[model samples]
Target chain A: MSKFYSSVTKKIWMSFMGLFLMTFLVVHLSINLLLVFSPTTNLFNEASHFMGTNPFIQLFQWILFAGFVVHIILGLILQIENWVARPKGYRVKAISEESFFSKYMIHTGVIIFIFLAIHFVNFFLVAKGIIGEIPKTLVDGKSVDDMGALVIALFKMPYYVIGYLIALMILGFHLDHGFQSAFQSLGLNHPKYTPFVKGFGHFFAVIITVAFMSIPLIIYFIK
Target chain B: MDLKLKIWRQPSAHADGKFVDYQVHEISKDASFLEMLDILNEELVNKGEDPVAFDHDCREGICGMCSLFINGRPHGPDTAITTCQLHMRRFKDGETVTIEPWRAKPFPVIKDLMVDRSAFDEIIQAGGFVSIATGGVPDANAIPIRKQNADLAMDAAACIGCGACVAACKNASAMLFVSAKVSQFALLPQGKVEAKERVQMMVARMDELGFGNCTNTYACEAECPKEISVTNIARMNREFLVAKLS
Candidate 1:
């Protein structure tokens, strides 16, 4: 346990788990965007139903949930350890000129955590019929459960769409640092490949964020 | 060739420090920076005043004892050279040069421009060694290290334990120094036997000594007299990971 909790070892643990979370986000965005392509009530219902009832998806979701908890815990641990390592009362005269995303990761991460809580309350609880009964849906010659309806209805609320979009942008900013930094934590940075890794991180963050945010906008404004 | 010097003067560690201005007249351009300072000290002694206190042992630049932040640099304006190797030709006549000691919590001001860097020695004593039994001296080439690994270990070993890296860093981080030491030993087969415990112990000691975290600003490498690469820090991270998992 002492070996597991050592200063350098914690960085690798955080980076591996962060990369795992990044993969999970990619798959999640892909599945969420299916609603945008097929907006018909029955089409979304069938998709959501397939996702809900699949044993593989269920297992993966559990893994993702555990990953989220561990990632956050380890991230907090690493931050605390780094803080403790530094000399007390010493201040740098020079201001760090890195991007806002890179410097304020902990802050952005906290905001994203709040977004996650809202996301869980709005989607996860609703889908499981835990908080409120999901309304019925009928279209495309089929009847469906109300999880898809709840999403569409929530998006229709302008405030909810705006909130979701804001959350996604924060998520984008978090990934901008988290993705590249995790590789750095894992000692994967080399002169020939570091810039490429950083570029890919920025690009991947933008794509995930833009794709996810587009779903809400399409549901709220277009359909 | 006259040079104006603004040297920090403090009677004792508990005394308040301030700069004392002096003018060195007719200095040779070929004179080393510390030699020039020595001439200035002789002048102060002739004037019946206390000479500035600074640290230096080997004028050849290998002892790593000479430390002076000349004109806002660890070793004057030159890159990849220690203070003792710095020449007066790097400065112009009538220039006011400011000299200071290593400023970090771990390194406390002793007097004038001299700072106590025993914190580094403490960190080293924590784990910076391999427990080899002293019998007869082993054959020099018995290890048979790969060319690449030998070169890397030699490069890392080039770090002379200079506190310049700490003084040059914005955060006063000792990562480059600690990592270089760790990499130098860990790269060889003899060192690899205890590589896990070595990295773990060194990093833990580094943190325990109140040094700042490495932000990879490259300042330490830039100002390092040995030009020890930040790549050593990355290597340390990898070694720690391999040790933790396997």
Candidate 2:
């Protein structure tokens, strides 16, 4: 059999793509945190402008998009294959001892996808000059797309805040399982370190969710 | 103890199957789960009814033959034991016990609760072995295997090829079974020669047979009669990647 069609190969690629997207989350949360913690300065706007226009970051953005696309496609394929594997349903509903987050990965994943769609249209497209006009502001004495202002404005809306918070919460659930799961898929498990990885996954999930959720709520309530 | 059995009954592979409820009175609490079924079959036979067909061998845990999904659990709610090792004391009096076969596309129900597990045999035939010269018995210490590796390999070797891992999986994945087989050989020096081809071939056969890919939910580990660790799965993944890349 060709290695491309192998289940293990598909899972390995999925792991790589998942880990890549997770790194993007780290970078994203770091920059967005500036919006809440350093609102008075141009740090958030400058960081956002840098991310949007920097040649290296611009080149990496396409790779990032590919990461998202590949992850979703592979996930769907595996899930479909999983469904087909069990054509006959059991008469008695078996009680599963699996983690609640692990069982509904696809559900949480679809919600995250929806959130990403709306999120890209709201910020990414606007910044790219594809949808609405980019709001301009002076960053380091040069006018650039003021992504921070747009983010703050959107967060101020109650509905947007509510939706964003819910999506972030769902994302937390996805990451809680995905983080350690990615490691397992990559065959990186070790008895000495696996527990640590599992713990850190939970910690990472909570941190990302809380940090992202805080920005919007702070913007709406305090800022 | 008296019990109500909701057993799955199908005449043949292509026949329509349904749950047929039967009552057993004064069943000994000390009787094994299979023994309980045996008594029920005896009663049915005496009544001139079709006996519930199932699988069994040594009536012990090692053979991995007895496969009954009792009460939504493979091997009747017991951990680290097969169906034959499960005793009736695990259940309460008058409890309704549900019995079914291992549910997966690869393992089709042959009769009532017995499934044809020849798919596992086919996967094993693909490549689950190390080819060695048959000239002479090699000296035991000549190969010199590490204690740690030997222990781990033995742990992987503990798998009895039962379909419980497949049954318990939400996706009917054979990852735990295949991984255990792969690791049993992959962890040893003798197995090093054909390790690459072994994992690749077994995994391919598994996918071809329509077993699902593992999402790492670990339901297999929970329901495994032998309690095989999922670490073997990670080891198999590592072996597969190394094989593919090199």
Q: B142-177, model 2: which lDDT tens digit per residue?
A: 788999999999998999998999998999999999
Predicted model with the maximum DockQ? 2
Cα lDDT for residue B118, model 1?
A: 89
The alpha-carbon deviation from the true structure for residue B100 of candidate 1, after best TM-score superposition, in angstroms, is 7.4
Q: What is the interface RMSD, in angstroms, for predicted model 2?
A: 1.7
Considering chain A alone, report the TM-score of candidate 1 relative to the true chain A: 0.88
Model 2, A1-223: lDDT tens digits are: 2235878888899999999999999999998898878846389888888898899999999999999999999999999989998999787777757766989899999999999999999888898899989768887789987787788788889998999999999999999999999999889989999999999999999999999898888889898
Point out where model 1 deviates above 4 Å: A1-4, A39-62, A87-92, A95-102, A130-133, A138-167, A189-199, A216-223, B1-63, B66-115, B133-143, B163-173, B212-225
Give the chain B TM-score achieved by candidate 2. Answer: 0.98
Which candidate should be chosen as best, given lDDT against the real structure?
2
Q: Tens digits of per-residue lDDT for model 1 on B32-56?
A: 9998999999999999988889999
* Model 2 lDDT on a 0 to 1 scale: 0.90
